[model samples]
Target chain A: MITVDATGLSCPEPVMLAKKAAKDNPADEIQVLVDNATARDNIVRMSRGVSRTASVQESGGVYTITLARP
Target chain B: MESVTKERVILIVCGIAFAVVAIALAAMGNPKNMAICIACFIRDTAGSMQLHTAAPVQYFRPEIVGIILGALLMALGTKEFKASAGSSPFTRFVLGFCVMVGCLVFLGCPLRMVLRMSAGDLNAWVALIGFAAGIFTGVMFLKGGFSLGKAAPTRTMTEGFVFPVVALVLFILSLVTTLFVASAEGPGSMHAPVIVSLIGGLVFGALAQRARLCFAGGLRDTFLIRDASGLITVGILFVGMLIYNLVTGGFNVGFAEQPIAHSEALWNILGMYVVGFGATLMGGCPLRQLVLAGQGSGDSAISIIGLLVGAAFAHNFGLASSAAGTTPNGQIACIACIIVLFAIALLNLRKQSA
Candidate 1:
């Protein structure tokens, strides 16, 4: 699994980071860390576009989303 | 810090350049008190679409087409062109709709608010103050963690170019129609020709992109972070446009007889208040959204669509304010818009778990 931490990032950064991580490791699972709901949604939508499934877990303001190939 | 300084310098230059181009365009046939207003042009376009039967204002604007095409070229050259969408599209639509409703009530966007003030409309002062106040409210929401989510990337570039393509088609249609139909009287007849407007738009677009200039962002940042870099550009634009207007004898100094504006002070302030608040919440003003859309932001594109539809609704339902003043229905719509926007903001506010 490839881990990309985008905590505290806003708008396009979190989505951009998650996209980079997923594209770089197509065969592995990708985990993205974000602090806002928008980033979480963006990552989830991006993952879905690539035919992957995404799940989200929240703790405090931090959100952890994992995307994996199905 | 260096990056910030560079950004500020670029913004200042762009603001000054915009003022100069606006004055020149006005001298060359663009309407008095308005050289480049995205909202006004969209309002005109809305008329052309028969969404509103406002006869004198209907025309296909070349400046808008130029803004999109200019930005497209710059993006392509810099390889920043990427088509993407995934943001909460429906929410953006609603936001855009609210934005237009608010702006039409005020008779201008944030950019035009400043421009109107520069032209000596004391009414614009009220609107500007209201805009700042509304942005302040939006800053409060941001501090409490309000967001609209991010946009996902798309594989097809065609999706990204949809707005630009439509703009191109409109440009073609404008040319074809000119052969058979004369331009409408008043504002529609006054234009700087397609080439001049396009060039002006290109210059403005490039400078704005480099500086990240946004009137709504300026107010939002001032309230949220106490940063004044963005506000400085706004200040310069106001002063510059004011001076230019005076030199050109365009300064009117009153609410009465202002082009495309009404004398209704309360609704004017309230209208901009809604626009300021909604734009601040959505992260940018209408002009800023257009620029962002040009930069391949799907959320902004959705917002633009909302703006178009909102303009349609406003005219169709007789909700748009006029030079005489806002209709009773327009006033009612303004009140309803405020309540709805505030409700949305309240619902989106982050709550502490007790």
Candidate 2:
């Protein structure tokens, strides 16, 4: 699993970083942590390319999206 | 805050925040429908800085400073303050400049376009149509692999703090020279009290920063993903504003005699087309640009500077339109901006596809 803490980053940046991470480690389940909904939406959109399902977990205002490939 | 889901709740909050802020600003003495206009405020700020000699719209707007401050404070507190730049800064600048020019030609940015429509300005309908069409065109380019490249993180965090610091300096300067530099006449002369305006700006800056509220982004999202969450926020704001206008007697239907607006329908449409296209290419609207700058994007800062410079150029070079009608120079400038933006889109988008 690869964790990318994108907490506090704005839109496109979070997605961009997550895309880079997903591309770099294609086999691993990438867990992206973000604090805002817009970033969450964008990250989910980007992750849809490589993964069919995204498991989401929330705690203390942070969103953790786990993208697992089929 | 934790209860905010990625769906409708965030959109509702953003909608309510924008609506409440717009109404409050209007009640406190901004122009009738234009409680907070990014492009207009930037133009006024430029005039106040003597970047342009447009006397009527010259005033150092506290809202402009407050938006950056609010965003910076939030970003820093959240530990998300990453200073970054170098994503085709010059191209972003040109896009920003073109966006401002288009807004000037139409006398409003995307935010103002919505606000104007909410206030029952029928002409805004034309502008809105033009905006959507322009976005449609940009989306076609995106389908062809349009991109501005990714921004790299800067070496120091201090780079991200620069814009907020500059805002603070500007606010202090406005305070000391209140009587001298502040506009004594024109639209710039009419303003909400400094404290109220600053507070209004702060609230909006914080909310928008948090929610990533952007008009252009909303439209873009609607086009790209069948998701209407952001567009719903905009719609809710329109409803909120409409209710407020109705309650406060601010609602007046028909286009003629609207304050600080023109009746030249074609120019208004073409002008906003330019704004919509430029903003699409830049990846955010004028308001979003301000928020991004606050969050430590140096590229956004350059774009903001471009907006200011573009405002200055609009007025100083007689490229800005007036309440009476569009100037020949303004029309010519709008055409030139469209051509330049198309050229940029073709050059960059083609390179990416290759």
Candidate 3:
């Protein structure tokens, strides 16, 4: 598993980081941490491009997005 | 801690600066409630380039070029420029085209939507609701499996620099060529001086670049996360323009007889719906596309090309609306665009989990 803490980063940046992580770690589940809904939503969207599923969990103002192939 | 404070200050400053400069430009004769409309300005630029012969709206807006150049300068200075492209370029083009159709039909982009509301054009409120509805719908798609594939890094940094170079070339071309013509009358003929427009564009571009300002993103965040960090700019922007209009005696409140706007309530709502929806699919607003181009995204450059082409098609085919009202063809086109966007959404989705 690869983890990325993308808290405080804005839209395209979070999306880009998620894309990079997904590309680098194919076959492994990639996890992303984001603070805002926009980042969480966008990262979820980007994950669909690289993987089959992205399950998200939110806790105390932070979202954890895990990307995995079906 | 210091960086966070600095970012907050910059955001507030940039937001205020954008509002003040836009209203000031409008007062100085750019257009009422249209100090900086990416779609209209781009359409005007197309006319200036003689891509379309719509006599009422033709002029090479320096602000458009200035935006790219300004962003380029910031990116270069900060060494944050990364040239990337090749993520569903044609779909982006189609989205850009449809967005222009919607904006021209509504007579404004997202920026002008806010400015018009600030200027007391009540029609903008309807468009706002429609925009919000469209965004809500698009967010539903995001929650589904819709995706536009990832943009890979370009082989060379020079590939990213192409957009800036294109901006420079356009600037030079505007200076030398009568190929680019100014309008003799109508919205096309009315404009602030070229130098002022350029300066305004540069300031807005630079500030928006640093602040990462996006009108659509603001609304999206508000709806999705219940966060208002982006929406804060929207509020500040409205407040700034409200003060500017009141002070300059430009505040006119009414639905009918607003300058350069149509009162066809349904079309106005539907037109902006297309803009809000298409912008969401493209991952940013029209202004955001220009900024991304400056930052060396070839995909954005392609999307900008799509915008220019869309503008040409809109004017040439009578798909754009006017002060009188939306044309029958324009109305049909707006509805068709919404359906097409839905189709795009459905077509791009991954299959459901079994």
- Model 2, span B32-116: residue lDDT tens: 7778999999999999888998889998889998888888777777665668787799999999999999999999999999999
Candidate 3 residue-wise lDDT, A1-42, digit = tens = 989886644464466567777877787888898764546666
Please provide TM-scores computed only on chain A for all of the candidate models, following their numbering. 0.92, 0.90, 0.93
lDDT of 2 at A14: 63
lDDT (0-100) at residue B211 of candidate 2? 71
The TM-score measured for candidate 3 stands at: 0.85
For model 1, the superposed segments whose C-alpha errors exceed 4 Å read: A1-70, B1-4, B177-183, B350-354
Docking category for candidate 3?
incorrect
Fnat of candidates, each listed: 0.00, 0.05, 0.00
Task: Show where candidate 3 strays beyond 4 Å.
Answer: A1-70, B1-4, B351-354
Best-to-worst ranking by DockQ: 2, 3, 1
lDDT of the structure predicted as candidate 3? 0.82
In the range B1-354, model 3's lDDT, one tens digit per residue, is: 124366567778888999877976786779778888888899999999888889999999988988888877776775556677877889999999999999999999999999999889999988998898888777677656566765666778888888789788987888887668999999888888888999889888877777667888778756654445677667888999988888888789999989889988899999999999998888788998998898888888988998999899998999998998898889888999999899988887755332
**Ten contiguous residues with the weakest lDDT in model 3 chain B:** B1-10
Candidate 2 chain B weakest lDDT stretch, 10 residues:
B1-10
What is the model-wide C-alpha lDDT for candidate 1? 0.75
CAPRI band of model 2?
incorrect
Model 1, span B1-354: residue lDDT tens: 124456557677878887887777777888877788878777777767666676776767777767767766776765555576766677778888988988888888888888889998888888987788888887777666566655555667777788778777877887876521324796767888778987888877766655566888877655654445567777888899888777778788887788878877788889998898888777788877777677676777888889988988887888888777888878888888888778777777555321
Q: Is the docking of candidate 1 incorrect, acceptable, medium or high quality?
A: incorrect
